[model samples]
Target: MATAPAANDNARPSRLGPFLRSPAFGLVLVALLAAAPAAAVLLGQPFWLTMATRVAIFALAALSLSFILGQGGLVSFGHAAPFGIGAYAVLILADLGFTDALVAFPVAFLAGALFSGVTGTVALRTRGVYFIMITLALAQMAFFTFTSLSAYGGDDGMTLWARSTVAGQKWLKNDLTFAYLAIGLLALFLVLGNRVLASRFGRVFRGLKENESRLAALGYDAYPVRLVAYALAGGVAAVAGALLANQTEFVSPAYMAWQRSGDLIVMVVLGGLGPLHGAIVGAAVVLVVEETLSHLTEHWKIIFGPLLILIVLLRGGLIARILGGRRG
Candidate 1:
């Protein structure tokens, strides 16, 4: 039988590997993926530009989820609550004529912080399945609450007259520019996330995932650490939501539904939970498969269903397995 490595063996320092099998390679690949739309534009294919843009947007969201779910084993099933709140922040403010990205973006971050602050406090009191259920409940509450708001078009959702302006300029309305913006933000967040994961806080967070009791024995308080990580993840997810509103130009209560949260989890798992950028690969694969399948048939999910299962069974994930090399 294949046995897991000893803790000491797992603790050995790591080094970058071959181009085809390194985390650095995966990141470089992601950068090229970001540039793909520009290449498509050169080829006179506007449709691919739009699809690549969506990949950037969801990649941001799934990247946020990766911080907690992929890195620390914090299974937050309510990620969509903050994500949807971020979208609604843009929509509601735009409806009130506050369409500047500066104003709306901050509001979205605050909204996510608010949700995470309240629910995370309560959810952190539990662990395992209890924690998962609490997160789901909180997400559903946000969903239903938004659905009941008739002023914002309730369950039907609201649309924006125009994309959020940057410094009072309509830069994002341009498809190519918007794609670049999304890619830029994704890169920025990826850098920020890497710092967080590489820091002492991240080590402690991962330690808790392995053994909370042992970490506690070492004098680290899990509550505060977990709470902070959860809040940060929520804030990041909300930023993704804000960008998504600009991409879709719509906000609906449906964004916060439990199923969307599940999709985020799927993206994290599909990308491979080894490194942070795995989520990017997962997001692109999910969106591309979904888009391609949808065009082929109305019941495309039936086809996608088996395909996803086969993927899981065959390789678990593409980027983490191939680019990241064999898992420890």
Candidate 2:
């Protein structure tokens, strides 16, 4: 009864193949992030807890960019405008006696949304390279606007006297608590983004990306829809900015520099632009690599530049492999 084994049997895929292909892979990424603070404590590397918090904040920013860029086909080079606006929202609010996250966060979100909505109304009217340039110009305008505000320390930047509290409690002052809070926010946004992408609105947004002409023919006015999505993305990014301000206890014009927006784009590209979770992975990888390289030498970018070029040359195969999916 011993039949010869089929030739194809040996080619059976590993169990990991399915897991990697499944949505659970994204969950695992989130779980690892959630565990980072505790793991850092266990290893006696408390600095890593701070690093994880930074990673989570940047991931949120990148995820927001991914929302508009990946789905709506709106590549905003001025995305940092909202981010910077958010930080300033916190700074202004705290200065005016609103230091609670409960208050500052919503204000930051609305500030970001308002800025994005106003600028995106014009920026989204263009397409291709023109759109990119407009966003860059708009963001630079914001950079200079902030730099000229001498009252908020302008070019020198300003420091927060104390971190924003959680509902009037100083709970966020604790490193571990802050790290977990950041991770929790990132997880919540990832879930919401996934849901949005699966909804009818997401379908139209995606259609706008694939063929706006077709969507237009179908009687969908792409402008308002794109504008709404842009504003939402900006709002989310502003929240990240608020979190960043809290984490560093500082706010500066540089927070929303054009370069920061470029970094967000890179993170989205590095993560393959398919799933929002990839932004989390991309943010972690970029920050960790930069951190490691800086300790080795002052001119980290010399190494980083070529390394990034190689990654781009490879067109994100490394990320795709790790994420267990094809790049979008």
Candidate 3:
């Protein structure tokens, strides 16, 4: 009798199980991304390649946020701190005569991870709105600290004299090569993020989101696991920041601003707030929409603010209808 019941349970799949398990969705997304550069080249629109690179960078940053916010339920409002720190890391290294990506990128990643680890130790002690406020405060402290660095151009920002080189080669100086590099990094991390989220560590981290008490009862220490996830997210966001620095050839204290963090949050939420791919979609849509709206009017935010609210209100139904899944 027990065997028959277990068989019946196994036979009946959850409503969203197929949608989640299907590879068609991810394959389509990857194919579309891989085609963008080629399409731009064939169409003779180099600007599109630049735009695609920008989208990829932001998507990577947003994906990092999703790793914590979506999977671990750690809402970090100060995410831009690590991002800006990464950008500045490149600038600082360049000042020290290290303009190679091989040298700068890893340093930037470590800087970001270190900053996140130190701050998350304290921030994780709080929960809910308190956590958000603490992160914002910590990020503001970083922002002010950067502004005080007159040697690095202070509040006015500084421009990179040259983009980082690839193995002492000037490959990154070419827009096409740089765009592909950004896309390649995004693809690599997307795979890594998926793998991390599927591992045992991911299971426990997500459990932190769903029920900390239950997990603690099961002999799990939430602090160390959450800190590791937070640090990893910060490191990834820093890499995106480094790419952004390369793309713009500029670094600013403004990158560490609370508003920048809010923009990151918007990207994650706009992208559907859970899946990493949603961050990519959200970054692309937000950038495209911002560009379009800016052309339409200088007061674009006046229109965008309400539009975002409406989307947030309707996102659940819209997503369920689009995915053809029962709303859980």
Q: How should the candidates be ordered by TM-score, best one leading?
A: 2, 3, 1
In candidate 2, the residue pairs with backbone N, CA or C atoms under 3 Å apart (3 or more residues apart, or in different chains) clash, namely none
lDDT scores for all predictions? 0.83, 0.85, 0.83
TM-score of each predicted structure versus truth: 0.90, 0.92, 0.90
Cα lDDT of candidate 3 equals 0.83
Write out the backbone clash pairs for model 1: none
Q: What range of 10 consecutive residues in model 2 has the weakest lDDT sum?
A: 1-10
lDDT of 2 by residue, 11-111 (tens): 34466756653556667888998888999999999998999999999999999998898667677898889999999999999999999999999999999
lDDT of 1 at 29: 54
Model 1 clashes, total count: 0
Candidate that would win on lDDT: 2
Q: Tens-digit lDDT track for model 1 on 213-269?
A: 999999999999989999988888998999988998988998898989988887887
Residue pairs with backbone overlap in model 3: none
- Highest TM-score against the true fold, candidate: 2
Q: What is the C-alpha lDDT profile of model 3 across 298-318, one tens digit per residue?
A: 999998888877765654334
- Look at candidate 2 and tell me the lDDT of residue 106: 94
